[model samples]
Target: MHTVVIGGGVVGLSCALALAERGGDVTVCEAGTLGGGSTGRAAGGIRAQFSTPVNVDLSLASVPVWESFEERFGVDVDYRKNGYLFLAREEETAAAFEANVEMQTARGVDSRTLSPAEAREHCPQLRAEAFVAATYCPDDGVADPHSAVQGYSRAVEERGVDVRTRTPVTGLSPPESADGPWRVETPGETLSADYVVNAAGAWARRVGRLAGVELPIAPRRRQATVVEPETAMAESVPLTVDLDRGVYFRPEREGTALVGGHFADADPDVDPDDFSESPDLAWTAEAVERAADAAAYFGPETRVRNGWAGLYAVTPDHHAVVDEARPGFVVAAGFSGHGFQHAPATGECVAELCLDGAASHVDVSALSLERFESDEPGTVEQNVA
Candidate 1:
């Protein structure tokens, strides 16, 4: 079976690897260089601290892959198992943390709710007085996003998968009948494949439209800033998230940390083609202020080293849509901001769906696009940073 995956980001590369492993002829098409899209700009957090079961399951399934990434892909991803700390300031949010921990623990996540003092013990830089409660998962950690993408790209190509960079998929022709092959048109050539996977990251909606499928995915701009702290932060400090403030920071190097989060007032929908690639100075200033409030080490004297912007392929419920949009068109997009972390398991699931007609690794049927058509869209993940 020949499979053509559109988008050479992490997810696309991962799917290609899985399909190639299954003895299918696979090709990955990228409009730009590998990981040059959102994957390169991601903070690279891998955590099972989500409030939703599906998100937690995805993280859990991907953990083993991330832990043994170097062994599996022959590349060091810089996968760190320091931990993930989610702090809640408001009483209501604190209560949610307690409830979320319960759900996470029930699913074998090894997450626990923490008192303010306990949370401070993990990261002494935190303002203990500001937060009411927190959740800590020792299994959660961060990795190098660029390394992971490159690793997957290399592994897939080694397995006889054709990886074409700077190749934009212009259009798609779905089969007249369910069994017919799909036509994938590109600038230089057109290819016919038994299956097509849309893992186009920020441009997934446009890709879906080419297949005559109206995807709910939209591109939302997210900004991140790196700063050198006035006081060197502890290397043991976990990737900390101030849930109440919508701010998160993780150690980038010895004294530098990467910080950013969602700003409610920022443009929810951004034109992926024309949006600013450079970070906004004002927004970076605000993010630095918020980081300082969460961690005392990040004081007023902290120097903003640099900043950048990336797009999140967000769905209506801020969750991923990993299912077959049509007979031969499968979607592995609309992951909001979780695509990087979830790519491993999503790739397995996408391959299973295409090759075996079912996702047996982890039941991701809940992420189907048809879920949006229901009266209730199910639970929305609260732990989004």
Candidate 2:
């Protein structure tokens, strides 16, 4: 079957690679350069500490790929398993962490709850007295998204897949008949495909409209800044998160760290094409201050060196919609902000949906777009940063 995959970010490239691996004719259409969207701007966090089972399952299915990416793809993605530490200041949030750890433990994730003192053991600079409780997962970590994109892009092209960069999809339509091919129109030419996979990242909602499907994906801008800490941070320091404040920081190098968070009560959606790519000065100052409050490594002398902003394809429930929305159109977007880490599993599922008519790798039944139209839309992932 001829399958046309839209978007050339890590997720889209992954889907195209999976499709080609399954002996399907695949063509990847990217509006911009590969990994130029959310994939390139991602903080590269990988974790299985989600509150939802589906998300954890996605991590379970994908992390193994990341663990062996260098050997399998012949590309070094700078994969680091420095771990992720989540802090809770409120009693209710601490109780939720306990429940989340229990659930995570049952799913084979080596995560455990920690007292404030025990949390300090993992992160020496942490202000233990400031937090009521914390959670730590030694297996959860990060990798370079750009490197992963290079790996996947090369793999797909090697498999004889047509990867069209700078080719924006102008129109998309469902098949006219039950067995007719789907129409995908680009500026240069129109192509017909047996299947069309929408992996458009931040522009997913717009792409969905072209196919006459209304996806609840919104583009929300998130920023991260690199700061030179007053005190040298250990390169092995785990990605520390002040969950209550939505602030997080991870060691980037010998003495510098990447810090980010959304401090406002409201996270309004922004235009994907018009939003600022550079971080806001006010937000960067607040992010650093919040980081300083969480750990001693960041102080009044912390200097912000550089920063950039990216969009998150947010759904109302903060989970992805990875289902066949129409007869031959599949959606693998609206991952909130976890798309980069979950790309492998999502790609496998999208390929399965296109070939086997059901996803066998991960149970994506809860992530269907129809869930939004129903009364019980399910839970929203609380561990977003």
Candidate 3:
């Protein structure tokens, strides 16, 4: 239990590979470098099409560890299952996608319900009069957030766990036995650590005020757009989405295409080196007029050749705090931007909340920090960014 995991992205290298595979001598400190923040500008949309139920049980237990990330992390995080549609532009978002496809098929999640002529059997450049309903799923996909954090930072530093790149924690606090361990601070250097896991994406509330704890977290600046498809399309093609706006797109490799978070947010200012990615060209011209009749790259000469800007550590309800703010301080950041597909169930729930304090995987006791002081909904994840 000599933990220290701070932030190496992909949910702090999947929480230092589940606290060094439960042996716990992990280290991982990364203040910069290594798929930097928001897992290196993620648009890596892997999905369970959640609306809740602990985010569809953290994408159904993180889809068999992202389908065994290249046979257990050798590499190749190109895990593209090619499926995830979601469009619905009317009748109340198609009756909330018919109650979220009957609650993602009662939680088994292979979801369905298309019509817009079965979403052209999975996007034949959809535009079926611009979505009246579409839900698909097939298995939900996309990957390669820096090859899944370089395949979980080279298999969690070979289970010894000292990833440390540039080491900039700057402060953490809580020592002298609140349960011991955690003094941290860094620039020159300092350390203590019995446990201290705040996977600081979007600076987890200024690293929780260096440990006095304010952590309401806030970052929210998303932008993505990678298209190059003049027309060849299907590199498998899935992740379509139009969900009344917050745009989306997929397929990218050669006949590229990788749209953006259509819109509903983006304020920016929390500059961790600010990659303001400026392309809200009036929200991309109102997402090309609400994704022009469904969208085949919403014509009018579809452009946008480049884009980048990511950061969504929002909190105040978009859940993810992960408790124990005292007792050696823990608090897996604000994953309001869906921390890289919930990095394998937040690395087995921050290694069972740092070994046996709790974490039945998804209970996360509602992800604590006392639910922002009794508002009652810590880790409040209501499908964000």
Clashing pairs in 2: none
Deviating ranges (above 4 Å) for candidate 1: none
Question: Between the candidate structures 1 and 3, which one is better when assessed by TM-score?
Answer: 1
Summarize candidate 1's per-residue lDDT along 44-112 as a digit string, tens digits: 999999988899999999999999999999999999998999998899998888889999999999999
Question: Candidate 2 on 166-273: residue-level lDDT in tens?
Answer: 999999978889999999999999999999999998899999999999999999999999999999888888988899999999999777999987876478989998
The Cα local distance difference test for each model comes to 0.90, 0.93, 0.76
The sequence of per-residue lDDT tens digits that candidate 3 reaches over residues 272-296 is 6565656666665565555445566
lDDT of 1 at 372: 92
- Clashing residue pairs for model 3: 130-294, 246-262, 247-262, 319-379, 319-380, 319-381, 320-379
List TM-scores for all candidates, in order: 0.98, 0.99, 0.35
Cα RMSDs of all predictions? 1.1, 0.8, 17.3
State the lDDT at 52 in candidate 3: 60
**Best first by TM-score, ranked:** 2, 1, 3
Model 2 scores worst on lDDT over the 10 consecutive residues at 376-385
Which is better, 1 or 2, measured by lDDT?
Answer: 2
